[model samples]
Target: MSITPTPRILVLGASGLIGRFVTDDLRQRGCDVVGVARRFSGGQRVSPDDLELPVMAMEASALAELIRARDIGVIVNCLGVLQDGPGSDTGAVHRDFVVRLLSAIRQSRRDVRLIHISIPGNETHDRTAFSTTKREAERLIAASGNPHAILRPGFVIAPSAYGGSAMIRALAALPFELPEKERARPLQPVAVEDIATTIAWLAARPLDDETTKAVTWDIMQPEPVTLGDVIDRFRVAFGTAPQPRITLPKLLLDAGALAGDLISRLGWMSPMRSTAVAELRRGVSGDPQGWISATGIVPKRMSEVVGARGASIQDKWFARLYLVKALMIASLVLFWLVSGFIALVISFPATTAILTSRGWPEAFAVPFAAITSMMDMSIGVLIAFRCTAATGLVAGILLSVGYMAGCAILTPDLWREPLGALVKTGPAIVLMLVALLTLDNR
Candidate 1:
């Protein structure tokens, strides 16, 4: 008896919300799956089975070698960025990477089936750089003359939350509603499971299966839903009573988007970026009949996906703290930045006088205060940036401890000062620890 070989599937960006689910689902179905992601760091735990590679920077030849070496039969590209920032480029990630992947497939002389995940919109509706680059990628993939399937999923809802889903959950947990205009926009959602199943179905088909090849289908539930409906479903899952919700103003939402953009440059992928706001305004909608008929996937609706059993304690905690986390980080940044700036720039003489009056040598006290203030400022700067936030938090905790210890020995009277300046460091340190603990987006 001959055994049919299970094709090896390569999932790019396997650490992402959708990619991780797809990778796990495919492996469960008995297919050999190789998950590749650009280094997984911080709290976003890396799977021992997944490979860490800067795939976006890899050349076509290098990608070809990886494909051939892994004996990969299908490539699922789930890699994407919400906006352009320090380490993320919309054009490079969406279009340039796909171009090289297609080239690599051809170079390997393998019949690799490319499954490209894209946004739900055509050129006319492509407003932001994110959408423009995504549309270009689709065009490139279709014209590549390779066997491929483009799956454009709408407002994807997965068990694990990140980006827009995280924002929605946060909103639902709050005692507020988006303005009626914003709430009424279409937000047709599809379960991440359906997307994984679609990929698996295509993978299981024969190479000559013409139906799955070169097709671009929007994979979503047949019936459309409003943003308000999705939020209400989450509210139901959370067991929250329907009360008069304080509607958020448009001006506030726009300002939040501006703040989100600033945060993005610091390395954090905030879901409230201008691009996300614009997309939210435009709403998500696409014809799912073609994908339904092709893959026979009955996508789960928002209610089914959120579940009727109600949210777990962990879910409630996460939803409530989602926005708080941002505030905590911001406060910490300002606490350090402003304090340091004042000490180093505005109150340099007063800052130096503290140590000097404590019976310290003038020469030693001057440099000591200056250096420490600069260190404080550095910690604040580090915490402000997403990439270095962890290091900054750690440094902050340690330096804070050092300051308290040093103060107790050198200037014990300062602790009992009316302002309780030294005493407050304890809570600040605790906040830093909390920020570090909750930093992971995945």
Candidate 2:
């Protein structure tokens, strides 16, 4: 079958995972693509060579000028950074550059489709100064009266030309402590391709169709996992049994996070800051179903991007996988003990729901909760004693996975979307992992 003619699309931040995926997807779809970056190799309009450059040069001031000069039809602004530091640049791109570009687009005869990728978080996604700036940019886009879409992508994990992910994998080869929140808190890790497809769906969306109208959409991993689940996956991927470690009382790290944000405000940016600690712990995120309903693209499984991290979970033995699982569960029990009963009461159902959905009935609905609920205050005492951690974790994982497997065997894949695996169901699994891992860690 013949393909439809693709539009002329321009991507800023062309070196980023989202940007790169957007670049490749657009090119594959036959869109005429012009990439922009501050220090693009050979300093040319086209992508550079074998080393696989991130199109660095597009950060240049002349980038918008290039877009207008080239008569670009669509602009995807994947331009953003986590902090206010030197390398963590986004003020201009998010605030000034976008305003300037949209204004310029307004002056032109051809209507431009503007897609801005933003996240709603400050230090760790709770809407800090960094997040505020993005909100400002989004407001400007909406007020500009241009055809635009605001895409707020959740945590993105993709392969990079840079060595950050590799370093983590290398570190995993040795015994090291994973982050505290990583052990317990829920995570919404997303595949890069998923983000790309969502953007493309918006970018190439027909202007006349209400479905394509530019609006704000949250792009998230269909399923979220806990730090423990991710670490277990990490261990599996790297083929290691390294003991993970971490500290509690997360606020101790806040000062560093705040400082990092200040630093990122001025420089290239470091991904590790106290803010992430906060996010991991909180597991704050919105549902992506609205976007999926409107745009028709769901995120790829977190496992797909495991390749980007160079970590494979498919090979690890259950024992190795279960250790982090143990630690993670212990951690959650600690958090609940620390947070007290209200938190525990609210958290347990969702946590158990994760187990139940999989195939583990005791883990899921009745007898387990009934048994736990029936236990007196002394039961909490027994849980805190530590002797029960291993048995609890083992029983939980088996019941959960077993039930999930049984259903998968009996049901169709379509019916399995929300029940199959942590990676299968969407963000809930990530939360379940967090609750369980922390309880194990405790």
Candidate 3:
């Protein structure tokens, strides 16, 4: 397996939570690791050695060329989406991508070992599109006749959190109790380190090792754990004292999922999507004996994995503000949209009258108010989309500042207005700054 002296290890979706950790762990172990992601920048902890490519968009031939050119001996595919939405298609990411990947592996004519990360569930239990498509990918990989190992990890707890893990952390930090049904649901957890270790172990296996090749195994702790058990562990880790907790009704959870779905269409990958709730309801559990027998690695329990040490200040801040961040962004979007709509549509004449009062001609003031109102709405639109949210926040902040300054110079009397309308821009500006600062998803 190590014929090339320094064989290359390519990790797809390298910017992701699990992908980032796996890529770093492999490189630290002296493996020639090349990471790939849709978009990577220095701020995102992307190594200069990593390649920035939209891997999901690549065809079989393109993938084959890259695999051959890089002399990639192993590929760890960590690319996946929680649900189908804007810029995320479960079938495309899980099923179609795997088909192309298998074809590319054959065309490359290299002894590439595919270490695919998948969910832990059987076909009958695969109700959501995310689980269904993932199972389909597993089937394709098993039938492809490639040197491969499918690792179905259960409730992965990683240091770098996102999606469901982040939501769990938020819930743990907050002083609230989950419903009895959710609390009692089985949730077999596994540390991200164990998954990486399993992959590294498989990568070093001999080509003729029948046990490790073309095998699908569930990689998780053997001991049974529940959802409430995980949250309590996290609360202990955060050093939060026990208090009277209000249990939320199932109806509220359903509403949150619907809202999450709406936000996902705007390109924001909220973990509260209906599919996430569906999968959570199904619970996470599997037989890990096969993985244990093959790798001889004991999986770490939840306590050992997440609650080994007290939470740091940064960790506490992240856990507390995770869900609040979404709320703050949503509020800002609505604030801008409503403010613009009020000025343009609801009170168009009044909007221009204020300008005219400052010795501005009626004709010029009318169009000026109209254009500025449209600009405000445009900023809201920008902030609503994930890719341009930062730009929109910045624009909103600058425009707010401009408005404050312009009003101060031209219409100082407005500052003395009873409603304090001009002064309200200050708080809006501050909110936009906060949103811009906390915008990074990683």
The most accurate candidate by TM-score is 3
Task: Name model 2 segments beyond 4 Å from true.
Answer: 1-4, 41-65, 87-90, 120-125, 161-174, 179-182, 241-268, 274-284, 307-442
- Cα lDDT tens digits, model 1, 1-442, are 9655657899999989999889888888888899988866454444556898989889999999999999989999999998898888999999999889999999998889999999996579889999999999999999997889998999999888998999999999989889999999998999999999999888877778777778999988879799999999999888774756788999999999999999888888899999999999999998999988877778887778875678999999999999999999999999899999999999999998988888999999999988999999999999999879999999999999999999999999999999999999999999999999998887
In lDDT terms, how accurate is model 3?
Answer: 0.89
Q: Taking the tens digit of each residue's C-alpha lDDT, what string does model 2 give over 1-442?
A: 9654546787877765577667876778766777665544342335532123243333434444565677777888877754554444556556876767776676665667888888733333445445667788887888987788888776665654222232234334446555554466665666667777776666666766666665787777667666566555656566665565444344545664675455344331334465454444556355677888886675777676663454334322322343344344445444334433432465666645655665667633555554444342233333444455434444444544654665567434535455544344334335345544444210
Root-mean-square deviation per candidate: 1.9, 22.1, 1.9
lDDT for 386 in candidate 3 is 94
lDDT of 3 by residue, 1-442 (tens): 6363436889999999899999999888888899999986556655676889979889999999999999998899999998888788999999999999999999999999999999996679889999999999999999888989999999989987888998888988988788999988889999999999998888787756888778999998999999988988998898874756789899999999999999898999899989999998999989999999988998987878787999998989999999889988999999889989999999999999888988999989999999999999999899999989999999999999999998889888989999998888889888888888888887
Q: List candidate 1 segments past 4 Å from native.
A: 1-5, 41-49
What is each predicted model's overall lDDT from 0 to 1? 0.90, 0.56, 0.89
- Residue 166 local lDDT, model 2: 29
TM-score of model 1 relative to the true fold?
0.95
What is the descending TM-score order?
3, 1, 2
TM-scores of the candidates are 0.95, 0.58, 0.96
Error of 2 at 191 (Å): 1.0
User: lDDT value for candidate 1?
Assistant: 0.90
Q: What is the Å distance of residue 198 in model 1 from its true position?
A: 0.8
